[model samples]
Target chain A: MYKLIWHMAWNALGRRRGRSLLVTLMIGASLWGLLFMEGIYDGMTEQMIDNTVKSDSGNLSLFAQGYRLDPSLDRLLPDSLLNQQILRTNPLIKSRSIRFSHTGLLATAHAARQVQIQGVPLEEEIVHAGLSDKLAQGRLHFGSDGNGAILGHGLAGKLRVSIGQKIILSAQDRQQNINSLVLKVNGIIRSGNQPIDDKILYMDIEQCREFLGVSQGFSQLSLILHNPDNTALLQEQLLRELDDSAIEILRWDQLYPALLQGRQVMKTFNLICNLLVFCVAGLGVWGVMTVSVLERLREFGIMIAVGTSFQQIRAQVLLESTLLGLGGFILGAGSGVATLLWFVEHGLNLEVFQEGLQAFGMDTIIYAIIRPDYFTTALIAILLACTASVILPLRRLKQARPVTILNSQ
Target chain B: MDAFIEIAHLHKTFETSREVSTPALIDVSLTIPHGDFAVISGPSGSGKTTLLNLLGALDSPSKGTISLGQTMISKLKEAELSPIRRDRIGFVFQTHNLIPVLSARQNICYVMRLQGRSQQEQESRVAELAGKLDIEQLLDKHPDQLSGGQQQRVAVARAVASRPQLLLADEPTASLDSTNAERLLDLLEQLNHDEGVTVLISSHDSLVINRARHSIVLRDGRVVADHYERNDIP
Candidate 1:
């Protein structure tokens, strides 16, 4: 019975190759649309995590309790040695950075934009801040004279400051004294983040201490863990080691609510795109099945009269639908992956939208990233859509009577 | 002779969209002895086909008792009716109705396969039937490749391939020329005589009515005349 039904299905498909191919292509295009959006979402989220962890917050951060809200000099960590020891003892903490951050005056020929000055050990900052790799011009030099600073590219443009140009930074210390220093812009960095690009200034730890009037004290310590999801484990271990009164641990989500919110918006946008794709694909399935059923009514009637049971006939139709869906998914997945790989290797240049994207805090260039799970999900969705479309036709099959069908002519 | 098929008090009616009921078959009863060649004659829309469908178990009468062999078919469900058709009944249609995608041999062997007959048995039976029908040379030909007569011969072979106890034919020679129609009826008569297979055919052709061993005439959904022949006329 199965063999007979299969033969019938095969013959039916062969008899109408052009229509079958058209349906398959429709299904394939739908799958490709769904997978392409998913790939972009996956790629963007991954890039966000990488940029956040490698360039700024190292997966997680430890800050004094009130420092996140105030971000003032008075919220400086009393002691850095205990937190450093705690971080070092935890094997999950792959690397760590201790820094003092404050908003202060930044002067250049073009402008004097208020900037967030991050003070860190020059060598440590180079390794953990993703700063050393982003130099747009000149070199990073933490001279022993304590008079050098790194400016973000966008900030440098606004400041009209170039390499070897003099800039002044001013801030009040924890002791309530106004401290000022003159510094040379040793380098310009481009981090691809609009906020970071416009407001970041980096300097040597000793120089920052002198400018901020902080004597050997740090405000926050950021740790890069091997796995960011192990936040609970790392927090527990750090609490056990550090005196809770002097030190506090802050996860990245708490430290960057805006960034997290932005990510959530992007996720919701992707979900909407996914829903649209599903709807379009499901409609394609329904359209194709309905048309095919109508076109093959005579064939179906003949099969019924030939003693094929309703259940067997329905199974045959479902099998054909499933095969079509599987074929489409294979083609669509292949096309989507190929397109993503091409984009990943050669990113799409959005020079036309550069200004607008910059206004929205996004990069002009976009790269599509393909993930294994996205492909799996797309395939399952296609199969489900195909199955769902065939249900109506299968029900129709149950009510079909051979006598009525044969007499229709 | 023992009745091989008995249909008692059969009634069937169809309702149209305007809510008017039209009778297709009414109080029609019939009995045929084993190995007898029976012809049901009627005008267009006179319900001969309806009675044939009821007897073949393709449909149930609205009210009647139909017995094939020892089984009461009127109360049987569609699922149960299919196996009875597969194993006990053979059908030949007016237009030869061969599935165009399959070769003549495949069409002939289809019912035997449905009956779970072995491949060897199917092959032997198909060969014998096709040879008897003079279509052995055309077994591999598709329906479109055969003439009207050849197509009907394949249909006849298909009908008897499973060696059914009864054969129900609906205008088996309706599409054929007189020569081909005569040839097909002759083949059906030979099968009835040689295999002891009871034959009931619904046809309007005068040739078929004159040749059959038993005749039942229908008019306006009711049987008006029934006759039996004393001698075989080939």
Candidate 2:
């Protein structure tokens, strides 16, 4: 019986090909738009987060509890076997390094600016800091003695220095005395970040330690994760292992509240956009289905009069709507994937509108990402819309008097 | 056996609007034995179609008990009426009302399919009915493509394909010309006498009234006459 009804439903759709085609096209276009929108938006946000993590925060960070509020020499964490052991034992931690950042002044022949000097071990930073990848000039190496510095793009602009230029960096020593050094620029990094590019500098961690006259202390332990999703678990485990009252652990969300809030806003905005698209598609399907049902009023009456249960008729209608939605869903998903692949391969260049995108902290070139779940979500949304559309038509079916329907011309 | 289909004290009324009750059927009782070819003749507003609707389980009586086979259907819900109709009763309407989407063959076989008959049973029965109704050549043609007479032939084939205990047709010949009307009435008679399918058809045409083996004349929602007729071949 159910099979017969299903067959009938399919035939009904085929018989009304024009209406069904119109409905399918409406839903398919909406779904395709939604898929593209979701992919692009998610890709944009994902790229931003990934660049932020890669260019700066290593997914997780350890700091002396009060150190971020006050970046002072005295708050430096001691470099010990405990730190080394924790890094060594946890397989989830991809890489760990010590960083000693201090505020200083950089002066050159043409310019002068206050700079935040970042100290990294050359070999470790090469693999982990992605420092090597960001090089816009010269080499990433600071040499063994740390007498060289890599300038951020904006800092280089401000100091009027590039690779091979000489600059003077001066800061207070650990003992509260002013000390200075003359260094040549080793590399220039373009990390696409405003603050980091404008006022930050990178040098060898050992050299920064020597310049500060601190042999056993470092500012914070930075960690890169194999899978960033494991950051919270690792942070919890690391916190328990360390048991230090002076130290705290942080995840990317906690470390970057503003970015997290931005991602949330984008998500909600995408949801609203998708809902609007769904509403349009839903109204199309509903409008078509209502007309289709009305046009077949007499046929439905004959069916009911010939002993077709209302339940069976309702199922048949639901099946028809579902198949309609499935058609659109499949078409939408197929084209969505194709478009995403094209975007992923060639990238969508918005360089013409670069300033506008940059204002929102987005890269000029947008690469689309395909997440399978988005297709699932689109399918579910369409199915729900299609099913919900039939409630009124089904009610009409129930109230249909066989006599009246049959008697009508 | 208790009448193949029995109705007792059946009543139906419609509320046209507030404070007005118009009776359609009143104190109607009927017994139709198996293989009976019953024709109901009445003028418009005389309730022939209403009685057919009640007997087919398409509508319920306001106050009555209707037994088809063993199930009492008049008091049963629509859900219960469905299978009794699908398995034991078939309907033909004033307009052939063949499912427009289906071809003549599929439309004829639809009731059997609803009863979950096997594919082979459906094919054999559809083929048998097509041949009997002389619609074999029109099997693949949809209702709109078929002539009115062809559509009614398919409708009758559908009605008898399930071999139900009773077939209720309301104005089965209303849409037909005289020649086609005779063709359909002849088929209905063959279904009654040759196939032994009990048939109750509602019509007002004197030609139909003259052809019925048993004639039921209704007036103002009551049965005024019931008897066998010496069917005149005119």
Pick by DockQ: which candidate is best?
A: 2
DockQ of each: 0.45, 0.67
**lDDT, candidate 1, B31-148, per-residue tens:** 8877889999989899988888788776768898999888998988877777787788888877777877778998898877666678899899988887777898999998899998
Q: Which segments of candidate 1 are over 4 A away from where they belong?
A: A78-85, B113-124, B136-147, B231-234
Q: Cα deviation in Å at residue B95, candidate 2?
A: 0.7
The lowest-lDDT stretch of 10 consecutive residues in candidate 2 chain A is: A78-87
Name the regions of candidate 2 deviating beyond 4 angstroms. A81-83, A108-110, A143-147, A157-166, A175-182, A210-216, A356-361, B19-21, B63-65, B177-179, B230-234
lDDT of 2 by residue, B1-234 (tens): 236878888888877799998999888888877788889998899999888888887777788888887778877877777787788887887678899999999998888888888999999998877776778899999999988777877888888889887888888887778887887888788878776788899998877887887788899999888877754321
Give the per-residue lDDT of model 2 (tens digit) for A155-260: 8977778788889998987898888999889889866555677787889888887887777677767788999889888988888887558887788778788888
